[model samples]
Target: MSHQRARGQPALVYRTKTIIDARGHQVAIVDTENPTPVTAVFVPQRSSRAEVAGQQDIDVTRMIVSSDTPEVTSWSRVSWDGSMWDVVVPPAYHHGTRHTRHYSIDIRRRPS
Candidate 1:
């Protein structure tokens, strides 16, 4: 991607915590610590005619950011527009001559 196209706005990264209640049920909670600022491009998923006809309305967003960002795993969550998206897969790294240039992560909106 071109540098101009690659430049993206700042976004927030969140980490989740799982707590077992007194009843032994697992409860997941989002940490309230200040979010990490990362430059990322959020691209909404495009639906084809067949996908639309099949009644698939899954809204997936692809977030592209620098590969050097630390602790960005599949368990990481992205916050945008007051909603959280789950990291759907491992980060895909793009390598240059000596180091990675960027990484892309696909995120799907968490169901309500």
Candidate 2:
């Protein structure tokens, strides 16, 4: 297990990721440099809403703004699943060149 700190918060973040299709089926497994603390399955769009709605395992800290030429937008939510605060990148952002939907999990230290 790996450990990460989110800034001023004493909470530690454990990161794990699940990749699912639009129908909510696990399509691919996300490989990350972060340690797997707890496993959580996620759905795109709706999942972000759930976290914002305060119904799930993580809190959203920041939304990432990606710019190529036209400027693309992706969201990252920092949420604590009790043990760790995780930064989850949901499927709305295209992680693949040919794909528009895919998810990745990352860890961030809250800026002190």
Candidate 3:
């Protein structure tokens, strides 16, 4: 997880990065002046299906919720339904970033 402290705006939470394929030899540096805006969801515990479903009613492009347990390894993906957010969990593992209190939703574009 990363932190962004702008000049005037409040400190913002940034995304978490993991080394995908760092070879034993060379180092490739990617210069990104504009970082992608992300919507992070902080889940403190394991959330039930009902809890996840209830959140769909809100039009939150990026969201995260937590419970008292850590049983949920990944979160269900949420889609924009023109007016609100919709939850969709596919057959594959819906992995998200885990933090001290919640999970993060990383995307190239911010949710509108």
Model 2 per-residue lDDT at 38: 25
C-alpha lDDT score of every prediction, in listed order? 0.72, 0.32, 0.29
Local error of candidate 3 at 50, Å?
37
In candidate 2, stretches whose alpha carbon ends up further than 4 angstroms from where it belongs are 1-26, 33-58, 69-112
In candidate 2 the C-alpha lDDT for residue 29 amounts to: 35
- Cα lDDT for residue 89, model 1? 90
lDDT by residue for model 1 (1-112), tens: 4463257777788766678989999987655485677877787764333355545446788888776666566667888767877888988888864334777889887765
Q: Is candidate 1 or 2 superior in TM-score?
A: 1
| 30-69 per-residue lDDT for model 3 (tens digits) | 2223223334342222222335634522222233432222
Using TM-score as the measure, which candidate wins? 1
lDDT of 2 by residue, 14-103 (tens): 233567779989753323344323222322332232346545443234322221212111222233434323353442343544322323
Q: Which 10 residues in a row give candidate 3 its minimum summed lDDT?
A: 4-13
Highest lDDT scorer: 1
